[model samples]
Every structure is written in C-alpha cells, then in structure tokens.
Target chain A: MSEIHALSAGLALDASVIGGKAHGLVALMRLGLPVPPGFVIPTAACRVFLETGGLPGGELAGAVRELEAVTGRRFGDPARPLLVSVRSGAAVSMPGMMDTLLNVSSTGDLRAAVREVFASWTAPRAVTYRELHDIPHDQGTAVVVQAMVLGDRDDHSGSGVAFSRDPSTGERRPYGDVLFRSQGDAVVSGTVPTLPLDALATREPAVWVGLMDALDRVERHFRDVCHVEFTVESGRLWLLQVRPGGLSGRAAVRVAVDLVDEGLIDRATAVRRITPGHLRAAAVPRIRAAAPPLPSPDPASQDSATWDRAGSGSAMQAFPGSDPPSTGSSRPVTEVGSAASSGLEILARGRGAGPGVATGRVAVTADGAVRMAAAGPVILVRPHTSPLDLHGLAAAAGIVTTTGGLTSHAAVVARSMGKPAVVGATGLTVRTHDVVVNGRSIPDGAAADADADADADHMATDGHSTSEGTTGNDQTATDGRSTPEGTTGNNQTATDGRTTLGITATDTDQVVMDGWSIPEGTVITIDGTGGEIVLGVAETAAGDTGPHVDRLLRWAAEESVA
Target chain B: MTDLTVLHTLRCMGFTDLGRVASAAGLAPEEAESRLIDLAVEGLVTRVPGAFGGWGLTEAGKAEDARLAAEELDKAGARAAVTSAYTDFMVLNPELLDLSTAWHLRTVDGVAAVNDHTDAAYDARVLARFADLDRRVSPVCAALTAALPRFGSYRRRLSAALARGDLAETTESYHNVWFQLHEDLLVTLGIPR
Candidate 1:
C-alpha cells in the first residue's frame, strides 16, 4: 500500500496516496535534493478512519511505533520528546483548503491529532474553495507527518522559502525569503519580516550553500520553476515541501523558452504549458520606472508626513539606478528614522500581475480607509476584508490582506477597485493598531512614511524587477510637478517638469513624451496592462506584446534537450 | 417604552421620517418629535431641515443607539440566543459578500475582469446566488425575532428592501437589510463596527 512506503529517497507513492506536497517532496528526494524526513498517511486511511467512527486501532498505533523507532524519541515526552507537523494534502493542490496544525507533540493523542487534520478538509472555507476550484468534495485528504524542525530553536535556527528560479522575471536564480530563528509557518505566515534568501549566506553560510545547491539540483530535475518550504534547526536545514508549475504570465513564458534553451524540455511542451490565460496575465500593465514625481499638496494644512507618506507616489517603483547588491549577505541599510517605519519588503516574489507601482499610506482598519478618501491615497490592510468594508473598499489605492485564498474578499475587491494587491500573505496578522510583514512588527503610525518610500521604489523599480530607478533625459513633465532631481534613465517617459524646487534622482531614469499632462483634475487613462499613464480613457489595446515578453515567447518556441 | 422615545426611534430609521421609526417603535410622530428634541439636546439625534432630510442619528446618537441596543439584549437575558443567531448570520455573511462582489465585478477565465455589464446571463447567475443567500439568511432573521420582538422589524425591512431592488438592502446592495442586520448584530453583541 502507498501508506506503507517509507517517505525516503525511493518511495513509490502517487499523488493520490501521499497527497501532492509529500509526493513532490519525495520527487525532490529522489532527485537528490535536501528534503526533511517525513511519512504520509494515504487518503484511504483517512476514509477508513472516518467510516469506522475513529482511527483504525492497529494502523495508527503501528505508525506511531515506527515513528518512535526511526526518530529514536517518544511523542510529547518532556525530555527529548518528538514533535511533528500534521497537514492535509489532497490529490489536487488545495492550498489552505484544509486544517493544518503545527508543533503537535506526538503522543497517545496522535490519533486525535490526525483526526483533527482530516476533519479540517470539510471547513466552510475549504468547501467554498473546492466549489470554486472545481475539485470534488468527496475526495479526502492525505496526511503528511514529519519530525518538527524548530525554526525558532536558536539564534542560528530560522525558517525560509525558496523558488528554484526567480518566479517573477523568470531569471535563472534562486529566489525566496529567509528568517532567522523562526518556524516554517513563520515564513508562510508573514509574522516576521523576512530577509532575502541571499541573506542566508551571511546568517548561516553552510545552510545557504546547501540550499543553493539543492535548489539547483531541484530545478534541473523538475525542468521548471519549483518552490520549497523549509526550516533550519540549530544550524541544520530541513525541507518541508516542494512543488512545480506554479508560475504565470511573463515569468511563465520566460521559463518555458529558457528551459528549452538549457536543453531540459522541448518547445512543444513549453507551448503546451502556456495557455491563453498565461498570455493575458503577462500583458497586464505595471509601473514603468521606480519613483515617479509627487503631486502638490491641495492644502499645506495637511500633515506633511501623512501627506508625504500618504501621497499616491509613495508606493512608486524603486528608483531605476539602484541595483540589488550582488552578495547574498548584504544587510538592509537602516535609513535614519526609517527603522521605525514599516516600509515595503519584498515578501514572496511572484510574476508581477499588472505593473506600475503606486504607493499610499497603509490603512489598517476599514473605518480608517473610509476616512482616508478626503485625506489622501491609502492602501487597505486587513486580516481579510468582508462586505461591510465596502466604503473602505471604494476608497483604497491598493489592497493587502493577510489571510484567504487568491479568490478571497481582498483580491476580488482589489481587482474591482483596479488597484495593485497581494493576497494570501498567511502570516500577516494586521490589527487596527499594528501590522506584521516578513516577521517585522510595524506600528500603524509608522506605516505611512514607509508607504511613501515603498511607493517611490515601486514606481521606479516596476515590482523590484530592476533596481535601477528613474532613467535618462526622456523625462517629459506630465503636470509640471517636476523635481530638480529628476534625472531620466535610458528610454524613460517621465511626466515631471522641473517647475519647482529641490529634488534629486539618479541617472538612467527614463523620460518619455508628454502625451498629455495628467493634472489633478484631468482624468487620465491608466492601462494596468501596459503600465502606461496616458492622455484619456482609451480602448484597451489588443495587447502590448512588448519586446521583453516577446523574447520569452521566442525562447519557448525552441526545442528542449529533455 | 415611552411614546416620545418610540417616536425618536423612527427618526434614526431615516427617509420615512418620524412615522416609519415611530410605527416600528409603536409610537406617534408628535410624541417621537418630543423625544427627538430631548435627544437633540444631547446632540444624539437631529432633523435634516429639508424635503429630503428627516430624522437621523448624529455621531453620538449612533454610539448611544449601539450601547442601548446591547444593554437591551443583555437585560432581556436573550444575549445567548442572539449570539447564537449572530453566529448563524456570520456563516451566511460571506455568501452575501460574494454576491455583492459578483454584482460589481465579473470574472472571466479565472481572472476577475471588471463587469462592464455586457453579459445578461452572468448577471442573472449572480442575482440567483443572492436570492439563494437571502433564503439562507431568513432563518437567522427568524431567530433574532424569537430572541427580541424589536428585531422583527428587520425581517420586514430586509424582505421589502430586497423585493424593491433597493440594491444596498438586498445583499451588498445599498438598501440591503443585510447591512442593518449586521449593524444590529454588532450592537447586540456589544462589538464595535
């Protein structure tokens, strides 16, 4: 039986038997990647247990004995006891669709613990998810039980997640988040602000090296962008889960072509992998250059900092000239006073949906969002939004929610509002008073200024893809709200005209033609697909089909070595 | 309850002016106006002084209403019953929200695109979902009425609002009685909005 297979290097378990996550982990292990030791109880056992009105007597007891024998520890023992994470994994990927309990002290209560995990497959939220995703309801979940590697075990211990490749730009580099002394859920939860995966080098060199090598091997084996959830315990690394084919848009196109060029997969498979939906998603507009010009205050009476932070431009792209430091170990430059602010941190990198970063002050509460309409632009932050938050929904510049799936209240509302949003940031526990991102605790009051910096960076970098801020002389002042520092980078289209005082920007900021100055009163067209700030509301372009995206498609058209 | 006090309840009910809140509270307009004046002194309620304006709660009035409503639920010893009803309400809350979202926006090919209102069939499907949710919510309304007689008014107002396509009253539609029910639940539970 699939249940009897040891979750080791060569266990012949199907997705149906071990669930998708454990199956993928086993695949990685087979491919010689670093995966933690774990075993999966097949969905059949779950079915039998539920049918018989509790766990079958011998199966669970036998498994527990085996676990004790293998790990050389008893469950829930005070002295050197073993703890495990029990999670539900369906044959299909039903992310967050079932219950997951972390840090369960495995003991005589192991059966009860397993039952709890199994029962979660039927929660209202999970049921709704299945209904929307078209997954069958009767198909139960397989349980993956693994020895808990405490990410918070010591200073040297922490948690992180990594993609075998940059899922955003389809760059051939490992990308993810790393938090020292945290748990696997900690990284997924967004409870602690996470450093870039590269930070692992400075923090834990051996772990970082192992991770990078493992990532490389996994990428080669999967021949596609793969993501791994992992944790480190007292300097030792452990892999929790793995998956492939979770990319979309430009990144997807790029990977398809690049894999063929690397002789991994052939062009036909690449073509087959990309659907029309992928093409459509890729063409969504984004902010062109990081750091766009700020608008003049309507009244000087407004809190300068609130307005400064609240300014729509605060979420602008990163300035074009900035480059991501090459070393994996560069520490964050703590800008004076910036340490207190909750500026933007790149959480989990994904293919930029629609581009063009615009930042506004973070609005934590629904009431705060409604009151913000008259004040300035605001980004709505919530544990998850409900219908009651409609007034705030109507007024937000963007949306960031800590919980729910992709089709959640926050995501739907953000799409309706035509705002940039990131959802399913599991670890974000934002209250009316404070918010958490990447494990960093940020007071609500400090979030405003940080929002401004984020906006400036967002406008400049276009989703942190390029560190280079605003580029060269192509800058054309849009509304004559120009800053003296506006240096245009290569091939930039800036709307800023230097009619005002002190402002500075690095060279290479792109400056484009003044199509029509989008003044405060002048309602201009914003193409979420093209990242274009245009003259008037125009018909949606058939498609931009930009050269950058086209190059990716061209590569996908080639033959694969695999 | 005092006649004047019942009249003032109509004032906060809005639009139908003094009569609606008064009738719902089982009072007369003159009596309600007298109570409204007393409330006005406290700056709890106000008159709009226009053809469109009638009686409405000021910020303080809204707070007072919430406090008083919660006290009423507690004093009646119906807090447990109301709380149970509220839990049931929470279950149906998202379906209502989803219907509202679908009404405002349309999803095509898994990507939620703006609902330009081009597709009649899609709109119908969403409305059907709203209808389904409303049916589900009826039981909660009945339970609330069972807990407290005053809550009976919500059932009438909500159904009337839905029948009239008042939009807000239906689910997420503006006239949505659901919003009022939500407000009432919060007030009953002593939970802040």
Candidate 2:
C-alpha cells in the first residue's frame, strides 16, 4: 500500500502529511496504544483547497473512501452511519481558536466538510489567534477525520478527558470531567456541566474499570502523564486522542523525578525535561492538595443544575466575597436577605492556574473597575482582558476570563498583577448587568452586601480609608475591613496608631488574615515569595500537597516499570 | 398592553442625567423628570445625588422593567423578532467590547500597555472596526424599532455617540452607549447580570 494510504505502523510524517493532531495520534499508534479508528487528510490537500478556492478533488475523495472502507458503515446513513469529528489541528494547539464540526451527518459532503475545516484554519478569529500567539499564518492545518465514537451510546457509555494524573497537582490517577451520554465536543465546549470523574466508579463501574486499564496502558506507553480524550459505546471503550507532557511547575518536577525513580527515564533526562519555563510556571502558586476535594454533594457540583440557575445571583451578590457566609458549606450562614442578591456561585472549572478562590464584586468594564477600587474588592470578569483591562486588573482582587489559554493575555496580566485568576472558562457572559459564573447567571451590583461593607469598614479603620473599598467614599462604612484585617495591616496600625503602611498582611498563607474567620469553602491563597494574597490557600500551596502530587509521581514511576 | 413610550425607551437609557434620559424617552427634560420623580415615589427609580450621580432605576425598577418589557414583547408579538435581534445584538456586543478595550489598551512587544491615545493610527483602526460592527448592528436595531417604535431612539442615540466619538473627545462615548444597549438587552430578555 502507498504510504499515504497506510492506516498503521507508518514512519512519523510531518504535520503537513498527517495534520498536527493526527500526526500525534499516529505517534501514539506507533507506540502500540489504543486509538479510535481514524484517518487523516494531508495539509497538502488543505493548501490546494485554499488556493483553488475549494476542496482539492481527488485527495479528499481518496481519504473518505478509505475511511468508510475501514469503519464498515456508510457515511451519513442515519442508521449505522459513520459519523466523524472533523477538527482543525494546526502545528500549535490553538484551542477554541478554529472551528471543529462534530458528528457531521453527511458522508457525501465529507469532501466539502474537509475543505470547510481547512478554510477555517484561516478564519478571521483563527488568523487573529495566530497573530497573538506568533504562529506563522502560512502553515496550514491538516484535517483529521475520525469515525465518531458515541460517548452517549447507552447506560455504560459516556465521554470524558483524563490525565494519567491530576493536571492541577500532577498526582497520578485518572483525573478529568466526564459527561454521560454525550460527545467529546460537549466535554470540551463546557456548555453542559460535567460530573466528577470519580462518578464513573458508581455510575458505570465496568466502563470505569476499562478506562483505568486503558489509562495504565497509555501511561506505560508514553512514560509520562498522558491526557486522553475517550468515549465508551455500548460497553466498548474507544480512545480518540492522547497527548503527553502538558503538566507544569511542581507537577512537572514531580513527574520528571518520579519517572527517573521508576527507571523509565534516567535522572539526567528527567532534569533536562524540567525547563526554565516549567520552573517559572511551577513558581506560580497552585492549590497544594493533589486530590480535588472529593467531588462534594453540594448542589453546586452538578454542572447542569448550576448552569440552569445561571446568573440568578450575580446581581444581588456577584462577589460571594471570600468570607461571605457559606451558602452550601457547613458554616455559620448569614442570610443576605434580598432576591436581588445572587447567592454564591461556582465560576467554571479550569486547571486552577492560580491557587486560590476569592469573592469580590465583579467589574464588567475596565472603567467601572477603575472606579471600583475605592468602593470594594472587585473581581474583573471579561470575555478576555487585554492591555486595557490593566486598570481594572490593578484594582481587582480576582480575575476571570472566558477566552484565551494559560498563555493568553488575561492569565499573564493576572499573574503579573498578583491576583487570583481563572482563565479559559467557556460559556462566560460579561454583560453590564450580569456576568455568567460557571454557566450560572448573577445580577450586577448584587455584591454590595454586608461582607463588602465590612471589608470597606475594615480598610478605613486600618487607615487605608485611602483605598475606598466599595462602601462608596464613606469613610465610616469601613466597618468590615477592621475585623478582617485584625492580625494583619489593620491591627498593626490600630495599636501603634502611627504606621504609615497600606495593606499590612502580604503573606500568601495569611491572605485570610489573622482575625477574620474564614468561612468553609472560601478559597484563599498566600504568596510565599512576595507575601501577597494569591487566591485560595488550597491553590497557592497545591504543589506541596502530598497525596495528589506524590501519588502521580509514584504512578508515573510504576507505569515506567511496566 | 405594554407602554412602549415609557418603560421600553427608558430601559436602554441606563442610569443617566435628566437631559439624556428625556432625550432617550423622547420627552422634554421637565416632563421626563416629573415621570422619574413619580417613579421614585413608587420606589421604582431614584435620583442619585452629586455630579457623578444620575437618575437610575431601583431593583424594583429593574423588575418592573423586565415584567413590562416581556409583556410589551408579547403584546407586540415581537418575541421571535426581538429574540433574533437580541442574538444579533450579542454578536455585536463582543466587537463593541473589543473596540472599547482597544480604546483603553494597546499591545507592544507581546505586552498589553495603555493606549495612551497617542497612536492615532491604532485608534483609527479600532474605530473603523467599531464602525463596521455598528453597520452590522443597524439592521438588528432597525428590526427592534420596527417591533416597537420606542427602540428608535437607540439608533439616534447610538449614532450620536459614534458621531461624537469620531468628531471629538467624549468620555461617555460609543462604548458607554453600547454598554447601555447591552443592559437594555438583559432587561428586555429578563436575563440577570
């Protein structure tokens, strides 16, 4: 068979031939790991499609013909149909930057679909992403046409993504969100809220067992913490894609060290793998515990339930201030007493880039945020923050963005500003009156409550009345700030009455401050390096957590033994 | 029946000084202020004190607006058209925000820096995008106005904001107008912030 037609065991082809995503898939296949049955249309075809202003005739036809021949189902047949996911896999992963059509129903239009996917490789948005990321424009994408594995096939079926370990803490165990009776796109799009990966153990024990076995095989094959996108159909497990080496910081360090200990790689190679970028990334604070709080039974845990209730509380209390009375936790509760006040909210889940959770009134606009510094601690939520958001960013206690990745502008700014940040949270809406938190709606200006009032009061008594925390220029409303800042900046000045300092507690662990009793589930972080409040303490010190990190390192080492 | 002349028009005006509110509601300032004071008496609206303050709807005012807007939408039977228009509004919303961000910040050496208003060329590029986005938004606004005549003021006010933005330095410029329009959508759709 011609090299292009070969389905397996072919030498590594350039991304141009197999496309970036499929090329990686082929590499995994070469390593003897399970991959869903699939085929690729070379970038040469895409280049031709773009130049000729349509799909190159014979290449797409040939590729589709081969796909149907292998899948044993007619394309777009409706019954026993061969559905496929057409993805834009450029050399660099520009997630959500390009278009991906899933469960495409037409096999006859497969060629046109491939061309469409190719054309999207240079859509205005995609072009802009490439410019922002400094990715060269001319390197066209290769299209991957894979026979779709139905994640929602039956009771035993579902779709999910799993990292051989926790990507957040680099702890070894299958870690990722899973949605029953859904497809890969649903998991990635985050439109449908997902359940904890552990739910699979009870919901579909057989599938969960199969998934663990597959993970073990893939981890042993990659000799690294590998992330997989998979689906189970009618009790059958199918792996769609596998990737290695996305862990960063402490997780990366721990993974590398463990790999050496397991004899999968030498100590020198492990040392080499810990790049300076990884070290710098590691230095960014994270939730210290490796294992996420065992997915709690709080109603907030269900993604759909939370989304259906989207924006309900943003107006009344968008901030859910870090120390606000816990709505769902077993803690002293304070009735905010107004329908206008949005109850506490879960902003979407990401890799937890920074190690803390905070609550502050959300500032949707940069100007509004600039003005907000005096009123209260503001959480700057945006589709994504640019250089313009810096003023708001400077004033915000936390930042949440709907667009961009770890390397996006918002993440960089949040890190630079030394604020708690969550980025790449999909389905985010930042309207003037409300902002969507984790798919839930919250009313605007609803966060002006007793908590913020107290924070304002606390700041004033501490003499940072200059700071103006959200009580609207009234120096007297600075009631809460004094209590929250008791052991830190506020108390230090209270006793001496001569301290010229502003914001006394700079320590990361002490971000909750000494006297302010932290409510259960409120995220807090302390920067060990700059002594600044990072996010939640869980996030800031995540790397130091033993269970999640140590377990991952140990697992990677054990996999290497196999 | 819903009052197109009253609630729907004010929904898009947001918190504004008397003159702008009156202009948005197509009433004289004295007339608009009288109605506003009456609404304030009902606890549906309030006149904020000081230079930075303005006439703003209370939480009750927002609820009332949402209830009345939905009724007006149903009365005119413009829900589908308005919903479609709202989707179109959503499309334009992001572009508007991008323009706003560009007005405030710029990029250099892969770093986001303040726009500083020194770069006329960059400012013009962003403004051009805004203009493009505005052109696309016109049809949707027109559709909305056709469904309810009260929405006609948005076309005028939006154009006014853009024109001022193009001609001179105005702090409450195009972005501010767009922000109000966005607020108008949430109120109209009864989607909380």
Q: Report RMSD for candidate 1.
A: 12.9
The lDDT values for all models are 0.52, 0.51
- Which number leads on TM-score? 1
| Chain B TM-score list for all models | 0.73, 0.86
lDDT of candidate 2? Answer: 0.51
Lowest summed lDDT window (length 10), candidate 2 chain A: A322-331
Q: Please give the lDDT score at residue A180 for candidate 1.
A: 78
Candidate 1: stretches off by over 4 Å: A1-4, A50-54, A106-108, A186-192, A290-542, A552-562, B1-41, B45-62, B88-139, B149-171, B174-184
Tens digit per residue, CA lDDT, model 2, A282-325? 43333232233444323112111011000111110111110100
Report how far residue B85 has shifted in candidate 2, in Å.
5.6
Instruction: State the fraction of real interface contacts model 2 keeps.
Output: 0.00
